[model samples]
Target: MVTFLLGFTLSVLQPVTGLRGFDTPNDAGGNITLTWESPDSGKVMVEIFRSQSPLEGYQKVESVLSSRREFVDTSAIDGIKYYYYVVSIGEDGKTDRSEILGPVSSAPQWFNTKRWNVLIILILLIIIFFIFIRLAKKGTKTYIRKIPGLEALDDAVGRSTEMGKPILYVPGLWGLTNVTVLASLSILRRVAKKTADYGARILIPNAEPLVMTATQEVVKEAYLEAGRPDLYNERDIFFVTADQFGYAAGCDGIIVRERPGAIFLLGVFAAESLILAETGNSIGAIQIAGTTSTLQLPFFVASCDYTLIGEEMLAAASYLSKEPVMLGSLKGEDFAKIIVSLLIIVGTVLATLGFTRIIELLSTG
Candidate 1:
């Protein structure tokens, strides 16, 4: 009886069996996986523990149902050894500990092969862009569709000249950092040149100091290019308040007082877009607007005489410049869009036919 009692006590105090840990494969590192066999005696919960050293400082990392046999430790440090173990707890609070496993270290990989498709696409685009640019430099003709809003620029400027009224340009509420503002500046240069040629006054009121400075420079350059430096007025290009509504109010005041013949509202805008466009409409000003803001497009389209939507705002720079490089880049972008559209159509067809190879290839991990 004494021998049997001793053996039973030993069994009760024994640790859980068959615990194992290994480093996870095909990863950027900092991970280890632990697994264990289920306790045979009864249903129990398993607790996982980890430590930097095998013999000391083991802290519980996770608790899992008895049916689960695996845990992934994502907190492992790269280049540092880690130790782990498991404990099984019975429903009656009896606990058994597993032998610790040690010295697993995470490592980094130089490249992620999963992104190979992305790399191929990037290379192809670069090749296409360069090829088109080269062809353009060799004097290949690139056809661009006519944009009515852009085509109307000269007529707008001519009308302003005929009316003897200043042309008002608002470069939106954003600063120079925005792509839309940059495009606006490019359009501004073209407008300034037209106004200079026709000897008409052009007023550029800015909500940003940097934009004001850029406008002054661009307008002055345009005047000099047109051989009408005398017509360039520094005061006409001035900074207004940066406050959105305040800037709109100030621009409205200018519209009311100056009654510009042509008003160009281009760049990033918010609620102030409707305010400006409606005011321009009320004053009988010939308003031309363009913006990447989808919400503001309807307002411009409703209130302005002409509005350039979405890509037209981006294309304005290339269209107005007519430089070989810009034209080539634009054409390349169109080509890329066509390719992407074709791929989408093909992928859809294949997916409908129960072939998902293309879809899988395009999918990102």
Candidate 2:
């Protein structure tokens, strides 16, 4: 009895860490959702209970819920005044309880206007997105605040230029044909142009022949942009043997021999990430690395001065492009991220208080 009350109170409070709300859809007779954040420790278990009479008698009701936010309580009968509550049960019968969400109406919702409403919402979101795009075009910065990475590129390149050594651009192991590889090549255009302007040479040792080819085009363009096209040399952008370590060894050779001032490890990478980073560290080069590979992230974090983790790699080209599809996508991601975050906060509160039904109700609503 004591365990039930404590669970009930905490479930009502729904105290948690890292939980995010899943998208809410009303089609399921029992709408279910998930929370992104999980407990740092402890196995989280959920249970439901019911009462025809509030305090006197309550019966245990097992509810099927996802490992995430909320679940639909479809063990429900229409026109019946049913009471529902939950418990966050832990080991040894220890549990926290939630407040009842009840006497709920189980009749289908939006047997009303779903079809009509869907089109309206799509149009609204579309309009809102374009409006922001227009504002952006007029030189009106959106209300969102950011500290962009590309803005720092000049600093990275300038530092290298001052050091009187070559700059190393490694596009890692992804094939040249990948979109991200192409994006990385685009960034190299800007970086190369900056290097050329400073009269500092860049060395691009790529793992793929196709990426090597595209990179050559971009670097050539950069030199052209800086009006130093004659200064561009094919030897500066060369293909390294594609074996991971073989490529790493070639990059290492350039770092050691050419003594480059800056080393950029972009696109994709793996175990060689550490080999390259530690080498650059030894050379005292300003190393900035970006890659989408999760496994190698730790090495870049430790060795590189600036590490672009995860999707930041993809966002790099868009940011550099400053075009509508690119910038628009960037802004869209931010808005979606915000919506995702708020839902988490609410779901945690409802689940803690034994009101996970609120997650379902509010999410679907």
Candidate 3:
């Protein structure tokens, strides 16, 4: 009877079994997965613990129902060895522990299998880009729609030239790192070329010293390319105060004093968008504005003669230059958008018809 009672007590104490752990797969890797077999006797809550060494420093990581049988320790440090075990608590307040298992370390994978869809789409874009570029290089005709803001550039420069007044160009209040500033620089090159050809003086005021320096180089290069290097003046492309409203005020002063015939406001703008645009408007200067700032777009639209909205400003470099590589890349991205849109629509229809495999594939990827 004693031996039988000892056997029964041991069975009751053993509430969990077969505890094991391994590093998670297909991940950047700072995670370890643990699994255990719950006892068939009844429900129990399992608490997971981890340690750097097998016999010490064990810290409780998580508590889960025995039925779950699995847990992922996301806090596990990559490249470090770890030991883990589980303690199961029964309804009768009895507790039992599973054997420790580990010395396993997490490692990052080179490629994630889950992102296969992204890889395929990336490959597709590259193929499309190359194909379009090849066609363009072979002199095949490709159509790009008219952008009125860009088209009016030459007329604005000519008006300044005919009126015998200087043209003012604001390359945005942002630093050279801003993408809108880069786009503005591309448009600046075009304007510089036009001004050089027309012999109309161009004045560029910058809020960033780096942008001022870059503008000088860009304008000088444009002048050189136009074979009018003599017309390039470094002094005209200068830095104003870094303060937002102060820069706007300085630009306004230039408009009031220099009385430029035309103003080109292209790049990122904030509250100062209206301040500058309205100032130019008061001076009766023909203004063309473009920015990615949605809040300030209305101000530019209301004050400027032409406003290049959002992506139109981004696409201006390719549109104005017509370089085969740039145009090809632009068109390839457009094709990618169309493809993604079509897939979304098709997936929606399939899901509605109870064919969920397509939706599942997309969702998983």
Q: lDDT of model 1 at residue 177?
A: 86
Model 2 spans > 4 angstroms off: 1-128, 143-149, 177-179, 321-325, 351-365
TM for every model, in the order presented, reads 0.87, 0.61, 0.90
Worst 10 residues of 1 by lDDT: 8-17
* Clashing residue pairs in candidate 3 (N, C-alpha, C atoms within 3 angstroms): none
- Model 1: per-residue lDDT, tens digit, 73-98? 88888888888888888767888777
Residues 1-365, model 3: lDDT tens digits: 99998867655745577777888988889988887778755346788888999989999999887678788999989999999888888778788788889898898889988878778878988898899888888877878889999999999999989999999999888998899999999999999999999988999999999999999999999999999999888999998899999999999999999999999999989999999999999988899999999999999999999999999999999999999888887877787889989999999999999998986578644
Q: RMSD, model 1, all Cα superposed?
A: 3.8
Q: What ordering of candidates by TM-score runs from best to worst?
A: 3, 1, 2
Q: Which structure is stronger by TM-score: 1 or 3?
A: 3
State how far residue 140 of model 2 sits from its true place (Å). Answer: 1.5
Global Cα lDDT for candidate 1: 0.89
Cα error, residue 18 of model 3, in Å, equals 2.8
